[model samples]
Structures are given as C-alpha cells and as structure tokens.
Target: MYKLCHQQQVDNACGFYAGHHMLVIAGSKNIRKPEDIVLSTGPLDDWALAGLRESLAKFIMSEVISSKGEFHHPTATY
Candidate 1:
C-alpha cells in the first residue's frame, strides 16, 4: 500500500519539477507566462500546453496546501 509519506514525496518531486519548468519558461525569451509555455508558438500546439497548465496547477496547489495549511477550494473536483 502506498503511504501518505510516499505520496507526499512524489508530490514534492512534482512540485520541484513544475517550479523548475516555470523558471525555465520565465528565463526564456518566448515563454513568459505559464500559459505562454503551454502555447509554445512553435512545434507544439495549444492543447498540449493546456494539459501542462492543468498538471502544473494541481502540483502547485498541492504544495501550497501542504506547506501553508490554509487556503483551499471547498468544492474543487481536481
């Protein structure tokens, strides 16, 4: 069975990766916002970027909830 600790560890790793991705996008000239990164304006398309945004949003929200112990979506489905 997967323990909460294991889940947390995974979440932490995901949070780190998501943050890194955001940082890289911010540093890059073409990608300023998270939405921009998803938009890609090059080889990639908007649908894929939308998915990335959703995943990153989940990871970021999870990190914030774990660390701050406040602020939550009362009826968040995701």
Candidate 2:
C-alpha cells in the first residue's frame, strides 16, 4: 500500500483487506466490509512517504506514554 500510494501520489489512506479471486480497494472514511471496499488512490503520504510509518509509530508511542502519565521524555529514567 505504501508503494502504491507513493506511485499514485496521494494521502488519505485506507487499510487493505485481502480476498480470494479478486482485489478490492477502499478509502479511510468509507468502509462496508473487507471485500466491499471502495476503490481509491490513497496513502496520504504528503510527499514524505518514507517516514510516514515511523513517524506515526512515534506519535502513537507518545500517546501511549501520555496515557501512562508520562507526557514528556524524562531526563534520566536509568
């Protein structure tokens, strides 16, 4: 999907769900079923595709830390 998104050049991604004997596509905002996905040209890379996944992962980590009562990085947790 990242490669597809980069090739097509778009953002606003949708998660892919594989199926048998066919290919189905969908967008982030609209989903009916795994096989009932709407066709799309997405991934919303903002032209920074290479870093998107890592950046999102870091963002999620930050959110998790915030939920755990640690909103900022500690100077020394060793």
Candidate 3:
C-alpha cells in the first residue's frame, strides 16, 4: 500500500534532482461567458485539469428539479 506523505523526509533527502523538475500546462482557452464554457480533454493526461473539468460539469450543464422532483430535459442547440 502506498501512503501519501507530507514531505516529512524531503528536507533530509534534498538532492540535485529535486530542482530539475518542471511543470507544464498543455493548452488553455478563455471563454467569452462562464456559462457558455465547455471543457474538453486533449491527447494528454493531467489529474488536476481532468478533475477540475469533471467537478465543474454540473454547474455548466445541469437540470432543474420540478415539483415532482423530476429532472427537466435540456434542449440542445445545433
């Protein structure tokens, strides 16, 4: 089992490779309106980016509950 650590031993084991890593973001887009925004994945894997899109899906496109607690159908546009 792999337990996530809080870098307790990081300071003690600081090595040359520690400063060699770099973070990169693939691509980004600015939406004209927050509500008109739709996120799509590129040919890459990023945990942070993927999780962010999934979390925001509900807010971007969601159905409202009526008096009967039934979901409303969202009309699609061409």
Clashes (candidate 3): 0
Best by TM-score: 1
Candidate with top lDDT is 1
Cα displacement (angstroms), candidate 1, residue 59, comes to 0.3
The order of the candidates by TM-score, greatest first, is 1, 2, 3
State residue 63's C-alpha deviation in candidate 2, in Å.
0.8
Better of 2 and 3 by TM-score: 2
- Model 3, 26-72: lDDT tens per residue? 22245354444333222223464455556445534454333232355
Q: Across residues 1-78, which tens digit of lDDT does each residue of candidate 1 receive?
A: 311111223432455444445655567776445444432223323464466668668766775444553555555554
**What TM-score does each of the candidates earn?**
0.30, 0.25, 0.22
- Candidate number that wins on lDDT, 2 or 3: 2
What C-alpha lDDT, on a 0 to 100 scale, does residue 39 get in candidate 3? 35
Flag regions of model 1 displaced more than 4 Å. 1-42, 66-78
What residue runs in model 3 are displaced by over 4 Å at the alpha carbon?
Answer: 1-45, 63-78
Weakest ten-residue segment in model 1 by summed lDDT: 1-10
* Candidate 2 C-alpha error for residue 43, in Å: 9.9
Worst 10-residue lDDT window, candidate 3:
16-25
Per-residue lDDT of model 2, residues 1-78, tens digit only: 222222342333322112111233423336545544444444333454334456556765775445553555555352
